[model samples]
Target: MADALPWQQALWQQLASRRQHAHAYLLHGPAGIGKRQLAERLMALLLCQRPTATGACGQCKACQLLAARTHPDHFILEPEEVDKAIRVDQVRELVGFVTQTAQLGGRKVVLLEPAEAMNLNAANALLKSLEEPSGETVLLLVSHQPSRLLPTIKSRCQQQACPLPTRAQSLEWLAGQLPEMAAGEREESLALSAGSPLSALKLHEQGVLAMREQVVEGIKKLHKQQSSPSQLAEGWNGVPLLLLFDWFCDWAHIILRCQMAGEEVDLGAADMHKVLQYLARKSTPSQLLSLQDWLLAHRQKVLGKANLNRVLLLEALLVQWAGLGGKA
Candidate 1:
């Protein structure tokens, strides 16, 4: 297993020093932080035959099993398919596993990521296991949006909040990760990822900078009436739907912010400052607010993996966007 992230040092010490581990721990935080890593580190320590003050002893039989992904006592419950719900059957399997005696005769650890993916039924199924945990079993639930989780689920586990790294820390780490990228470009990536270093690195690897440039140019063309909604929607065929929605949602928010502040507010990045300012001036607060509401609603749908017609959705978004102001 990988080492804990630099930002998680203090958090690791706090968790590792515990004399008695909680039956279940809800590791809550924003996406792209290292909550999963922390949980895994804890899991390793819990199952280690010979644990050090810091963490697991890598040479131990238990650690070897874990490293080889053959640790019978460690269960990972997540959506079998990405961005899909965790079904009740999966949770039922987990419950069964929880009842079984550990094959290694040590602690049993279960890591459930994005715990909010469990729907009402699945969560209810998991709840029984949480309420009546089997001997020496530890459930580590990792969630990006804890608010979306069932109140009963939240109430059962000891919640641990993982915070974002400081701006200086993120920048320093990015420098080491992306040495070839210019400082300004790195900063832009970090800003785009909402200050999440790992996410920023991922966006960079996905060529998001180039994609952003293409999108910004397309929007500019869109405002000039040189490109129609259909055309731009087709043009952004390569961009992820969720990413497109995220950008549009953010732009609407910025425009609303500018209108309310009665001046440009420098939140961080300024990729679309002039365009957003123009929209703020041209569009009424109600128009921007309405657009924001629509964006937010659809963004949730995208996150929920709704069955959507990509072209139709993008066209609808652009049609509303084009009608935001008379012209740009």
Candidate 2:
């Protein structure tokens, strides 16, 4: 298994050193902060026939089996398809697994990621296992948004908060991860990812930087009346809907902040500094607030994977955005 991330070292030690492990642990934190990695490490440690002081002994039989992905007692429950809900049937299957005897004569481990993906029915089904855990079973629940989880679910498990790396730490890690990229580019990625180094690395790999440039240019053109909403929407076809919404939501916030806090407030990304300043000056507080509310509502729809007409949705957003600079 891979080593815990640099920022996860202390959290790892605290968890791995525990003599008494909990029946269920909810590792909650922002996405891309290594919470899943931490849970996996703990799962290995729990299932290992011979665990080291720090973690699992890689040479052990149990460890080898886990590494090979053939560990009988180990279960990973997630949505069958990407961004889909973890259905009630899936949880029932896990419930069945929870009732089984550990084939390896050790502990049974379950890793259910993004626990919020469990719909109401699925979460209720999983609650049965949490309420009355069977055998030496350990459940590791990883969630990016713990607030979305049921209160009963949170009450049952030992909640562990995985922390975001500090800005300096994130930049340092990004430097090593993206060695070929310039310092400014790496910093931009880190900023875009909200100081999550792993997320920054992922965003870099996904070519978000190039997409960001294209988006900024498009927005500038839209503001100039050189590009219409439909044209820019079509141009941004390659960009992820959630990402686009996030950027717009952030821009709306920055524009409002600039209006309220004057030039003293930070304007977020350097690329949008002047643009945000201009919008702040031209747009009234109510216009920006209303636009922000709309962005947030639609952003949630994107997060929920709503069946939306992407072109039309993007056009609507751009139209509202264009109207923000009314009478300018």
Candidate 3:
């Protein structure tokens, strides 16, 4: 994962040129735009016995050890299970690692990804290490939602923002990776990911477009009283809860934009634009706005692993959506 995305080359070069760097760096941005890979590359460069101007030497003993996941001086702290919180014990272990001298007599590197996943205890436990790590220790914190992190944690590290690639850049990169993908399909994937190339590829591969179509149609029927939340939930059980919420958030904005401006600004797909227009006509502007806020809040909840009954939550949201349009 040391391979940098095309858009990352300039930033990588800039970082490489620096003779001295901060003890810790917080790399943050939207999901799946290669923040982890960027962090890994930086770690490799820092730990490589013979680092070049651009990055890691790739042939040094240090580089080989890192490639083999046997680097004694390198540690990674992530949630034990996907979507679970990083507990305090994990951070405590990292603290011990921070105090120890680098086994290789080179720089010690630690990567803490999705830093927002650290619960209050875990976050607090890492503060001392972040504020004063051992000399030559480098901490790279990768986060998709930095806002959720404690202010103390964020304020300690030098922040490096990782922005989503431009639409054209993403399209070009995706085209290279997926040459057999249709032009329209590629565009759709990019749009779905909100300009995150890797995320778009995963969404397309997971067949989210087809699922989104179903969700949209479900919304239409629910608005007309032809469908119930349970019915739609049963149908959408296969769709990832976070992704379903993401699409709804996007559609909520699309409907609001169409109703207010008679055009789609954030959304692509001409057919979906027209469909959103129809829903915009049926739903009141105020309803869409409120629904958008609700969707956003719930999206965050989903990310935080809140104790939510999935079907019931979706049911409640859809019921509120169904109440939109016309006189009601």
Candidate 4:
């Protein structure tokens, strides 16, 4: 059986026992919180004829087929490309799969990862199937944002939420998983992960934990006027903007925590809090929210558009953040 997270084990057990109710389920949670992993585990359990009460029987023929990705009754619907919408045709194709005979002479499973990626037509198409699925076929829609799905879709399936681990739990888990990492590295990785262990592992594997430290240090130098915008931009030239946004969000969270506690914050090597405080003083909560919205919109706008200078854009955003009185 696939290893399930602690929060998921109970739900898996419950689902395993009551296998006769609904044929559709919505597994929703924050990004990188292992929603897909839980969905896959559930799929394996449902398809495993010899499943234990608690989980899948890993030695079964169905489990072997699933492991080899050759389970004839298993279907996965995902975006054709990164950042691309799941087309309506994909949903139509899934409809055909749902109507087919189960190759294992039992249940068929269709899993849609990031179901929110479905565009309007695609979502509506899938909603039709969810409204009335045939036979013992199980439709599992995995989403990071359940709110983005149509109300019709939301009402049709049993919704299950996967939550992030607590800070202490996450720390403990990381220590156990990454014993080779230094203490400081592990702590920073946990923080940068934003309570998601999988995200932490990915960041550690990509060497982004160290890269984030460098970026944080560079930002501090900018605040101290020890580094020029060009220098800062050059230092972070090829870094993923998503990582930059994550670092900034983490910095903001730290600042907010210190403000709430009315305690001195040791920004350590990256004291962007000075600038953050200046902006916070000049802006209300609503304004901060608006700034966040602008950042997200700008991120989408600049993702792959030509004729846009990334370094200049980054510099402009930093200057705008430093000068909150102006437009974001």
Candidate 5:
């Protein structure tokens, strides 16, 4: 098993020392930050017959079964289909799993990965189990957006927030893990990963880093007014719009930092300094906040299966961003 991330370690430590553990826990964080892995580790600890507080002993039978995905007492609930909500039936099934006796005569572990995908009925269905869980049952709910969940559900579970690792730490860890890549390649991989080491390593292995670079460079050109958003959007038919929004958010964060510090801005490989500066000049802090909210709303709409034109959406967003400058 991989070593636990910092947040995971802290959580494990807390669990070990506590005499009374919460029946349900909500692990909330950005996707691909290893929340699922952490939840599995937590399950291993819970199900281990001879468990230590820090982590599970990999040699144990429970741990072995978990590794093989055959742990009878462990159940994972997720959406039935891609982009589909988790239904009330799924939550009802989980309730049945939790109420049943543990096959191993030990703890029962129930994990709801991406719990925020649960629909209103599903969330309400799960709320009763969360409120009155079986004595030996441990419920782990992992969500990328806690705000999307019902307030009653949120209130029932202990919440843990996980943040992405620092760039330096993530890069150093990736270097040790993947030594085949050249130093330059590693640096580029890390940047493309946007502080997620696993994402960086995956992109490097898949040979998709070059494709992402081309897209990012195309975006930079659009930001610089050398190409129109319409022209740039044409080349990225299969690529997700979320990827573009992520790049924009990263660039926006850097620009905001530089603007606040009044520093000599090196937009790095990004070419949006002029556009960002213009917006910064015209917009108040409140307007910037609103712009971020708008972007997030659009992202959610896309994720929720809204039919939106990619090119037109990008163009419309750019227009709004430009309008921020007029306000400033």
Candidate 6:
């Protein structure tokens, strides 16, 4: 049997007990949840020659092949490069693979991860395969954002939504993985990852807690007219662009919330309150809302692989932040 996550035990049992399984199963939910792991385990079960009620039998030839990463019946389709699109050519390759008989004479499994990354042509290509799937084959589409996928593709598959872990569950799993993390650090990481336990551990490993301080301080210095955005951007060039953009977006949301609700934001970051205060004092609610919209648009552009100059991007955003309440 595959090793299921503590939270995945029930879901695993439910899937394993299904009377009739769909050829295409669309597993989706919030990122950093366990959707990928669950899909992988399911794929193993389907490919295993000796799948039991629990799952795959470790002693089978199929299990050994998978363990060695040479399972003939299993295929993975994903972006070759990070943040790149899964192009139509890749889906064409998949079509060729599926038409051939299974090498192992068992079930064939294709795992498409981050299914939303497939470009329009690729998604359309996949739609045909989903509509007319081969016998004894399963296509598992793992998506973090199902809305971005074509409605036709979504309609062809049975959807399996992965639920976010509760606060207690997230903390419990995170503590087990990162026992060395300070209690406050764990809390902050969980908050920053939006309650995804695995993502919280990743944040802890990446030292985001420390880098966040520098980013916040840079924002503060800009607000005080004591720092240059270009210099700040240089200092943070290695930071993940999406993460930085998301933080700025969150900051804008907090400032807007403070103006409208008279409430302090609690992201569990050390200096969030001070940042919120600075933003609240300098920007009107309407101004922050506009900035929020801009940040969101740029975030989408970055995710779409826009080849922007990083320094200029940061400078533009920081300039907007610094000028949020100008009277002009």
- Candidate 1 on 1-328: residue-level lDDT in tens? 7666889998898888888999999999888777888888999999999988999988999999999999999999999997788999999999999999999998999999989898889999999889889999999999998988999999999999996799899999899988999999999988888888888988899998999999998888888899998998888998878779988988888888888899887733366777787788889999888888899999898877688888999999998997876752
Report how far off residue 305 is in candidate 2 (Å): 3.1
Candidate 4 deviant stretches above 4 angstroms: 224-238, 249-293, 296-316, 324-328
Q: Per-prediction count of colliding residue pairs?
A: 0, 0, 1, 0, 3, 0
Say which prediction, candidate 3 or candidate 5, comes out ahead on lDDT: 3
| lDDT string, candidate 2, 1-328, tens digits | 7657888888888888889889999999998788888888998999999898889998899999999999999999988997788999999999999999999998999999989999899999998799789999999999998998999999999998997788888888778777889998888888888778888888888898999999999989988989999999998998888889888888888888888887637776789887888888888999998988898888877766577899999999999998887722
Clashing pairs in 5: 282-327, 282-328, 283-328
| Preferred candidate (TM-score higher): 1 or 3 | 1
- With candidate 1 superimposed using the best TM-score fit, by how many Å does residue 270's alpha carbon deviate from the native? 2.7
Residue pairs whose backbone atoms clash in candidate 1: none
- 243-325 in candidate 5: lDDT tens per residue? 66776666556556656767636666333555566555556667666667778888887666466887788877766554555
Candidate 4 whole-model C-alpha lDDT, 0 to 1: 0.74
Kindly list the per-residue Cα lDDT of model 3 for residues 187-261, writing each as its tens digit: 987877778998988888889678778877877677676888889987788788998887777777778877788
Candidate 6 lDDT tens digits, 1-328? 3457787788888887765678999999988888888998998888878778888787899989998889888889999998889999999999887877898897889999989999999999988789887878899999988988889999999999876778888888888888887887888888888788887777777888887878988877776777877778888986788889988887787777778877664534457677677668877878887889899999988877678888899988887877874521
TM-score-superior candidate, 2 or 5:
2
TM-scores for every predicted model: 0.95, 0.95, 0.92, 0.82, 0.77, 0.94
TM-score of 3: 0.92
Worst 10-residue lDDT window, candidate 3: 319-328
The residue pairs that clash in candidate 4, if any, are none
Model 6, position 123: C-alpha lDDT score: 92
Off by over 4 Å in 2: none
Candidate 1, superposed: residue stretches over 4 Å from native: 265-269
Better of 1 and 6 by TM-score: 1
